[model samples]
Target: MRGIRSLNHLPKRCYAAARRSEALTVPLAGIKPSSATPLPPQNVQVSKLPNGLVVASLENYSPTASVGVFVRAGSRHETVENQGVSHVLRLAANLTSKGASAFKLCRGMEALGGSLSVTSSRETMVYTADCLRDNLGTLLEHLVNVTAAQEFRPWEVSDLTPRVKIDKALAQQCPQIGVIEKLHEAAYKNALSNSLYCPDYMVDHVSSDMLQSFVKDNFTTGRMALVGLGVDHSVLRQVAEGLLSERSGAGAPVAKALYRGGELRVQNNEALVHALIASEGGVTGSAEANAFTVLQRVLGAGPHVKRGSNITSKLSQGIAKATAQPFDATAFNASYSDSGLFGVYTISQADSAGEVIKAAIAQVSGVAEGTVSEADITRAKNQVKADYLMSLESSETLLEEIGAQVLATAAYQLPDSVLQAIDAVTQDDVVKAAKKFVDGKKTMASSGHLTNTPFVDEV
Candidate 1:
């Protein structure tokens, strides 16, 4: 009552002032302001070491950095006697370098809160590390030393067999991967057909000495590249030069990838048949290669949209209408240095496999006969551009792109430039790329229930 009387006694000006000042206001000094304009994307800089090593780096203000070494040595370069050497190297070399205990190396990396991994593909082997900005030098030194000072021990190789066996087993279990491997085997007679995964027989036979020879022969400066993302180019170049040893001479020439497509069928207990039907696509970095990529997008692997069917692809949509059993078609255009495979991989119940395969082949044939619409080409270009841009968002992916570009082609492609190239593609270009793929002999491989999977002649 006393407070109410005091308020009533206040002057009109004072009451108005109190009411106006009563609204709550927050202090904003603790908040960070967002800029109206975004900073421009950083550029990738390339430099070659005096010893023929190529180093590429992109500088950014990211808290984490990626350091990777990419070499043009993978299964495709393996000899018949040393089939799984690259896969073995992926497990062994990084662990047991000379005078370095696998335990200590692993513990040290863990202490630094870093991660290391090795990946081998058909045409490239990459060892990459992700660490903090402050640990750049340590990561670089560790990478170079582990690769350079490696003595592939017999015990180390033997000890790592269980992990290697697990990888092989997992690949076998995934029908998709198994079918693709068989497809490559059927497509290429010798070189490009090299298996990416180790068979059980090859795993035990691959010796430490063989892996060492592979490292010595193929880890040459000319065929190797050091790539860093979110790091200084000059620093990466200096560290790479200071640590990277000189090479004697070039290694044996990698075999040329020839596409002599044929047929392969593996019988399995899987309920559905998995099939891969492919033909020659273009080499990497070619305009036609880009077109095939766009063509692939137009035809589309699985739909970009999640967990649903997209009837946009003529082949896939046609495949659905042709068969009642559950069937799926995913377009793939895998490109290597000299050659590539462009086709669709499908899965379906045995009863529907033949019809789906026929529909898939007709789709490829249809593309050659100018079946792609202009709007389809535009949408595919947009998807391709979007995917490429999304890749740029990751340091690891950007590192792969830059390093692969440098080591494979000695060229760099800005994201804008790649997007522009995709934009320039016409319906006719996509058709031409498709026709080029079909010009070569066709390769077909099937797994699971092989009863309805057609032979090459039927396809």
Candidate 2:
């Protein structure tokens, strides 16, 4: 007890002063927020290298920076034989690159206290590293090496087997995921229907050769973008020039996704029934899509504020009040390169699944058939814009958004422009976008206890 040290000599004011000093220490002191000055519409600088590689970067004041390379090689490019190639490639990211052992690469990242992760979507794959500004150059170099590295060792491929199996098992066990997977399948027959996850049957089929081939074919400069957040734009450009190749395949053509509305019902003993009924929504970043975005908010996702049973959307409220048993209905809108889906997902007990789905259908039909009020449209537009702006607060998400926008549209959408687009969406536009899916063959997917789940045509 005599040896025990305490800060008795330090005054309490010292702690307050330390915190105040910390708060005042800004990374970039010149950068300050001012309402009267009006911030720049788009501060992100985008440049294309001689090799046709697009480099997009956001300059800001932050201790941590997120940098990544987003490629167009995803499930859309996968063939029947290589259905899970993207998932395999995603796992292969940051593994042993040429001239760098896995240990060395991992050690290097660990030295900088960085985190590396890979995510694969329906039409893109993103490899991201979050680290300090001092580590940016090293991290960017690693991203390039990771992208172009050829060695997808058989041992690593074998290790992913259990992981792939676990992914499939987890999806099967979670009816929410199962219903969404099936909904995509039912919505689009061929191209867009490719599962984001590696399927159970295809787990054994994804090999190192297939992944390497995918990289060779799709990891091209034209099909990819190097993106950075909270990093100097000029620094990003230099890294892009030094690392990414000016040569590679332009990637396989994206298969046109034509919506074919149908029904998919999978029976599992999971007590809770999960069902999704959606119609084709809007294209990526399109006005119609933006309208649907507003409509989704207007339709309501769930309770706006937590704790209370009072839901904001008519459908949610209807489900809450109408169902004898407890249930939840959420509005969903999934977007891709060319096509989109707008629907409501409902989860309910087995005995009440049918009624819940029907109630959801009635709500959707009401939105499509009935005229929406000006106040609802105005509120939904504001909500959609707020959601988009809030998401931009994260460096990692901003990096992905920048890269994805570049890969998908070859242009950036400024936040102001997006707000203007939302502002332009009138009630008529909302109604039309809502009815677009309803007019088309409805996409119905049901999982879990199917006995109580409504059939496709029944609703």
Among these predicted structures, which one has the highest lDDT?
1
lDDT of 2 by residue, 157-256 (tens): 8788887877777767677877888998888878788887887788877888888777878888878888888788888877767666643446667678
Where is model 2 more than 4 Å wrong at Cα?
1-42, 306-310, 324-326
Which lDDT tens digits does candidate 1 get at residues 382-456? Answer: 888888999978777888889889997666878778878878888888999888766767888899888777898
Return the clash pairs for model 1, or none: 301-331
Which pairs of residues collide in candidate 2?
A: none
lDDT of 1 at 439: 73
lDDT of 2: 0.80
How many pairs in model 2 have backbone atoms within 3 A of each other, for residues 3 or more apart or on separate chains, i.e. clashes? 0
- Taken over the whole model, the C-alpha lDDT of each candidate is 0.81, 0.80
TM-score of 1: 0.90
